[model samples]
Target: MKRNIVIATLTAAALATGGTVAAFAAGDDETATQRQSSAGTQVVADRDDADDRADDVNDDADDADDREDDADDRTAVATGDVDVTAAEAIAAALKSVPGTAVSADLDDEDDSGKVVWDVDVLGGDTWHSITIDPATGKVLGSHTEQEDDTAQVRAALKGSSVTAAEAAQAAAAKGAVTSVDLDDDGGSRAWDVETRATGKADQDWQVDLNSGKVTTDRSDDDED
Candidate 1:
């Protein structure tokens, strides 16, 4: 009889997360019955505990969805002068605060008429927006942007042999590299760079992070 009671209690706990209750009852003489009767037996569950467990499961699922949304985010197309490469500006920003650069833009501010390197860096779950002077590599100012999940970003960059700085450096041979962004839409991470030169159309280049090879991307051309 005690054995049956213990089994019923354990069954209740297992069903608590599903918001269901199992009802089980048996007399001492009922144990003499065939084991087939246990098949339909129900076990009691704590209703309140079941609701709480269900809520916790929902919260976990929502958190996972939020992280996935952040993982596929894209940055704006940024332009800058070739006098200071994107790699140099990023290097300058990291010197001010140690972190990884996820995205960067060379902006010619319309209101201030000043060109600066605006970089987004990720450190743990925190994000920082840093500005640097393109000409002198001076730290202009910086502030906390927001929080982000670094799990996906870290995994994507694990196998990348070429850093963003190296990709920009390799693109210099093609033209004045303006922007260098990390891209992994094709299942592998690569640095996408933009460049412009006199009497030539603005060109987009991709630096294979694994092989360190520079190639022209015609996708942008197809859009035009």
Candidate 2:
């Protein structure tokens, strides 16, 4: 009876040891699987972050390229076969002419492919209409009007009783006097003066030469 009891106790001990070993092995396998899953998740997240960064860099590069393209387009539009700097240079050159006021007008082309600037100038007795080439700064054409005479212009002055000499002096104070003419309208004599000012806005004067009185003075306004 004693031997059987000892044998039964040993058998129970062996069974318990085997069960513990099996449980430990199963736990180890589960832990290893969980670790592999976590590592895989981290790798995928890293890859996604890298891709996002790369996309941002590509977007920035694309934006830079677009800006460069826009700048190139603007440069092309501003400058053609005719140099814009040259046009400005021509305008500057015209400002140096004596008894010539020069103003820039809308640039237009003629049949000869020349760009012209319409300038208004005041001479002793008339308003001189002038056209100049923007590229060459050369006078293309100029004309004087009889109605722009200074003596007649002085008669038209705003003041009630200003002399022709005073009107002429006033106009001259503002610009360069090119010529002065006398016109006799029956008993009334008028003086016509033409002048040129800087920046070319019109400054001619007309006055009564006989009485030294201004009969008509049109300085600021130009008829032609």
Candidate 3:
């Protein structure tokens, strides 16, 4: 009977140790699962942060492009206003002349804050002229002559070499002379005239009023 009791006690002790080992294994598995979950959350957060940074960079680029476009628009508007003022002045000057209709275009080459225009004066025909000013929209001087009336002016241009009326008439045949004035440029006689001419193309002419000669001839390219 004593032997039987000893065997029963040993079996009970063995069962208790096995139960303790099972509990420890369950705890370790739970800890490992928690660690894996934490690592996954960190990876997701990092990806979100990178996406936000990329969006910010794109926004900055768009803002810079918008500023540049605004600046270009402002510059164009300013240039257009100056051109309008110049055209009005030439039109006013031509109105003083009989049987002539005058129109003006801006000259981009004369950007020295100087008002320069390609003036077209049409009467019996067309005459082109260039008008210049020291200040924007202010007419300082002008040169103009005839284009189509070449034959008449060439014929009349003979005799005495230079006559204001004859030269004026030649200029008129091509178009019309809106303004004609004579002046001395550094002791050299200079004639300043404004005219508009027409051919296969419409153009403006600037004539030396003193010499009864054409100075500069400009076409539609000077307009916009």
Highest TM-score against the true fold, candidate? 1
TM-score of 2: 0.34
| Highest lDDT scorer | 1
Ranking by lDDT: 1, 2, 3
Per model, state how many residue pairs clash. 6, 40, 21
- Clash pairs, model 1 backbone: 22-42, 22-43, 22-44, 23-42, 23-43, 24-42
Q: Report the lDDT tens digits of candidate 1 across residue range 134-175.
A: 767788899996554467677767867887778888988886
Q: What would you estimate as the lDDT of candidate 1? A: 0.70
TM-score, per-candidate, Cα-based: 0.58, 0.34, 0.32
Which structure is stronger by TM-score: 2 or 3? 2
Give the poorly placed runs of model 1, Cα more than 4 Å off.
Answer: 1-82, 147-149, 222-224
How close is each model in CA RMSD to the real structure?
Answer: 17.3, 21.4, 19.5
Q: How many backbone collisions does model 1 have?
A: 6
